[model samples]
Target: MLRYSAFSRDPAGGNPAGVVLDARGLDEREMLAVAAEVGFSETAFLVPADGGFDVRFFSPRAEVSFCGHATIASAVAHAERHGAGGLRYRTAAGDVDVVTARDEDGSWRATLTSVPPVVRDLAPQDLDALLAALRWSAQDLDPALPARTAYAGAWHPVVAVRSRQRLADLEHDVAALERLAAARGWTTVDLVWRQDATTFHARNPFPAGGVVEDPATGAAAAALGGYLRAGGHVPLPARLTVLQGEDLGRPSTLHVAVPADPAAGVAVTGAAVAMP
Candidate 1:
């Protein structure tokens, strides 16, 4: 297993993920053991296949349908070992197309196109429960973006806050959220503040993954991009930036592109580096 941090070129920044470049012959039990031992937010297992590779993501506690940071880490590691190019990933959530290239600074960056995105309103009761669990009042919500659930690879409830302090205060009820996540199939509760027209600051509470907070969440970023596009909050064919992990001291930056075509997948780009 290889250790890498995604969404940042610095080894100490971004979210750390374990990448098993060649996971052939390893069963789910073994993979789970490896993931548990790695003790990162998530670990990725890559099995060589005919066309591309079959990928699986596993948190320490359980298997996840998709994990964006791990995908970026694995893809960049693969590119460094092999060559920078396109790689198809067959995941539980859906098939993802990833392209890798070297930046002008000679750092590897990977961009993954999510599956067709979906955005929908959150139920009132669910929203209330989420607010209660988060210790956030309805008044804390931003009027511009209504409460909603979004899905690109994994499902996350998008809750926009008006202030950055609201985004930073993330002391939440994990058990309550775990129950809610089980009930609603939610992977994370995305608390965000729109810094500007083209920039956003975000914090994600991932109860389902048994994590209090995720430094950089690729799937949630994609879902947020879909939410922004669906609600017409941002101009069409827009490029936005999400800044996260600041509260955790490991700042992560994610570049998101929302195309004019609604049917097209959202693109998320970030750099990854091997961790010592």
Candidate 2:
């Protein structure tokens, strides 16, 4: 049976992720079909491993290297079965170490450390084509945080908008964006609006995955955190809050903590609740 869990909240909200606790017999096509049937942005399929678990992520359209929200959901589900603490996940991208615990508020929270991240500047022609597909002009972009392609476990284009309104009004040509993303092997387009140094708003366009928008994107948040830290955009040893899905009304909050170590992976923390 497929289990549904909403990460970063107590079931009522946060990003909903589908978890298949046992998926030993499923192939890629079966997994993809399951994910589509579940109807979440992504689903986690877990198989037994030596001391932990082997995890794979599948969106509606295809398999992905890694997915943060689904990771959080699966970890919490594992904790519920095996008791809460540290759980190691061997994912397609790499080995991800996750810690699950009960917070003071009695909520189950999980933090996942991503793989080493990289950021590359976007080409002018590519950026122009993306803008045309999204119907966004250069004037809507923020000057401080220029456009770039960022990757932690997956690749995403980081587009910083000057205002939240621009981010809220997300209407893009799905086929056009999908072609561009497929050509570049990008998972999603991270549209962001910085409310302040520590607070920001975000929206993610995921045409390649056959999803219009991702309510809460832990992968993109990790990439953004790494991008900001690498670029010296934020002070070291700082934590940032990303408010996402507000425009979509799902309203997810992602907490990102940046460390001083350059080689360290970004820490993304959130709570997951089981869906009834």
* lDDT against the true structure, each candidate: 0.94, 0.88
Tens digit of per-residue lDDT, candidate 2, span 157-218: 99999998888888899899999999999999999999999998988888878899888899
Task: Please give the clash total of every predicted structure, in order.
Answer: 0, 1
> How do the residues 29-101 of candidate 1 rate in per-residue lDDT, one tens digit apiece?
9999999999998999999998799999999888999999999999999999999999999999989999999
Q: Name the TM-score of candidate 2.
A: 0.96
If scored against the real structure, what TM-score would every candidate get? Answer: 0.99, 0.96
Q: Judge candidate 1 at residue 37 and give its lDDT.
A: 94
TM-score attained by model 1:
0.99
The C-alpha stretches of model 2 lying farther than 4 A from their native spots are none
